[model samples]
Target: MDFKTEFKPLTVQPQEIEGKSFEIITEELGEHPFTEQQYPVVQRIIHASADFELGRSLVFHKDAIEAGIKSIREGRTVVADVQMIQAGVSKERLERFGGGIKVYISDPDVMEEAKRLNTTRAIISMRKAIKEADGGIYAIGNAPTALLELIRLVKEGQARPGLIIGMPVGFVSAAESKDELRKLDIPFITNIGRKGGSTIVVSAINAISIMATALK
Candidate 1:
């Protein structure tokens, strides 16, 4: 069979392509469990990672989106457990609101503390982030230990984050950490199973940032 092997050039703006992608994602997700406001956050997650399972796996506290939006609009710092999560976030979008992303896992002090405590750097970093960015948003997408640390600090009355995006992916305590987060009285966005990553966390923040921009 004779076939043309030439590639065709596309003539669509980046924004248009993104808009269409989101449109297709929404259609594919059809009738998810999220509310109208919450659906946007879920959609953004799916858009970022192209993981439609998020539609089913994602779980949100009733006020998670509201809390996230408030924090983003107020320019609250975004504290990430790992550098990957921090790097994946859209800095330009966050900067518009005078907010920025931070990751302490690679800090010298965090390394020293981790060595002394015999724990992961993520856990030590979270402790420092809690003290430095109190009332900010905590996005823990790589280490379950970090999520656990945040929960412990909050319970001990040492940390009070505006919102917690706990979607750590792993075979270890990822699912368990999310369970603990669900029990907290504070607002949070997490998933049901062990299927989450930096992309999911970044998407959640980007979604909130976009929504907040619309309000301004």
Candidate 2:
């Protein structure tokens, strides 16, 4: 027996794709705990990953979205934990407001410092990045060490980022790092368990950037 194949390509306007994606995501995700303001972040994450589990895993502070949007609107720089996260972000969107994406993991100074301190390059990179962009957005998606260092810096009153997007994906300390981030008395976006990565982190920032553009 032979059956005819039926395949239909999605024919939607460029602007309508995002709206349609959100509609489908919401429909599949059912009821989400995020408020209207926070929904965009969640929708973007699911939109990037096609994983509805993020709807339940993602946790946002009461003022997380508000602070993130404020930072984006102010043209604050984005400091990423790794190059992949930086590459994944929408540079055109960020540049619209005079902001830029920075990743210091590959810097020679960071490598030397990491070697001397016997720590991961991500930690040293975070230290350097925070100095360059004091009140920027911190997007940590690949390295738990970077997230931990950021928390330590914040506690020491050395680093003061406007918002933290902690979504590092790993088996070793990923969950623990997010737990520590949640305890900070600052604006942050994170998810429970071990389901996160550079893609979701970039998605979160892109969502905030898009929202900022709309607000302008």
User: In terms of TM-score, how similar is model 1 to the real structure?
Assistant: 0.93
Best-performing candidate as measured by TM-score: 1
TM-score of 2: 0.92
Per-candidate local distance difference test: 0.89, 0.90
lDDT of 2 by residue, 75-177 (tens): 8999998888888899998888899989999999999999998999999998998778879899999899999999999999999989999999989999999
- Tell me the spans in candidate 2 whose CA falls farther than 4 Å from its real position: 1-17
lDDT (tens digit, per residue) of candidate 1 on 183-210: 9989999999898999889888888888
RMSD of each: 4.0, 4.4
Number of clashes recorded per candidate: 0, 0
Name the runs in model 1 displaced over 4 angstroms.
1-7, 10-12
Q: How does each model score on TM-score?
A: 0.93, 0.92
